[model samples]
Target chain A: EDKVVQSPLSLVVHEGDTVTLNCSYEVTNFRSLLWYKQEKKAPTFLFMLTSSGIEKKSGRLSSILDKKELSSILNITATQTGDSAIYLCAVDPSSNTGNQFYFGTGTSLTVIP
Target chain B: EPEVTQTPSHQVTQMGQEVILRCVPISNHLYFYWYRQILGQKVEFLVSFYNNEISEKSEIFDDQFSVERPDGSNFTLKIRSTKLEDSAMYFCASSALPQGYRQPQHFGDGTRLSIL
Candidate 1:
């Protein structure tokens, strides 16, 4: 079975702290890895990483995928309370699998003001 | 921006009752999906629909689960008989293009289903 695991199921940090969330996966025919931020409502798109070494960034948030290690990391710099949410990672298969996505349990980050 | 929309932000039903979750995907989106996340659990994929037909479904999609695009604009997931375990937040998603196009699926706010 395809599997994705995240570390430190829950974390609490104060404002201005830089946090790193890790996600590791084991799957056949890797295609792409995606990050999502889920708050009280739904999971919103973050970054989708398909290449190794190249980092994708959006403002204070950045992510990179390591295909060699079969893992990815999401980094948030100078975090704010609004950054608090459950971060999810998903892996997609390369073969035509009808776009069936596999998701991780997610890391809950609490950014305290 | 175009967004996927779901009806009845919250639905409460008794076990053995039938329930239908409705969604309206982005007008130009051709691919649709249904997913659910139980409290404190990972969101799971239930089914994916394209061209008015189901392209794929997960093991969680059993006999009691069915999906349909009743109209050009509406997609629905019907649960024949609700179970306590079925209580979760059902999310509807859609992508404007086909898979492998590098377009991420956009999700709705989700419908919280509570089975008593």
Candidate 2:
């Protein structure tokens, strides 16, 4: 079965600390990988990585995809309490019929001040 | 910036009763999607709609569930018979592209459904 797995289901870090989140997937006809930050009720768009080795960055957050390893990583530098949230990883496979996103369990990060 | 909106922040219904979740996607978006997240569980894809028809659906989207674009701005998900396990946070999302390849999906705040 196609599955997306994320490591360190839960993490606790102090303010100013840096963290790395991992996501690995085994799905057919891979198209792209997306990262979202879910706070409270909504999952906000963070980054979309379609090419291998090229990193997508926004402010203090960045992500990279590795097609060969079938994995990706999200890095957050200078973390703040505002950054605390459940980070979600999703993979969308190339298909002619339609697009369905396979999501991971998500990594819950709590940044303490 | 325009965002997806869902009505009724919470809904409580009895088991076996029917429930309808409403959503208004971004005006220019071409693809619409529905997803549900059980407490402490990952978000699961339910269905995708485009061109006023269902483009694709997941295994979880069985006969009990149905989707429709009733008007130009409204998208609805109807659950024929609610079950205890049906209690979850249902999210509505939209994207400008069909595959959402480079364009990411924008999500709403979500409606929390409770089945008694």
Per-residue lDDT of candidate 1, residues A1-113 (tens digit): 78999987999999999999999999978889999999998789999889899999999999999999999999999999999999999888776557878899999999999
> Which portions of model 1 miss their true places by more than 4 Å?
none
The Cα error of candidate 2 at residue B63, in Å, is: 1.3
Model 2, TM vs. native: 0.98
lDDT of each: 0.93, 0.94
lDDT of 1 at B83: 99
DockQ value of candidate 2: 0.78
DockQ list for all candidates? 0.73, 0.78
TM-scores for all candidates: the values are: 0.98, 0.98
Local lDDT at A14 for model 1: 100
RMSD of 2: 1.0
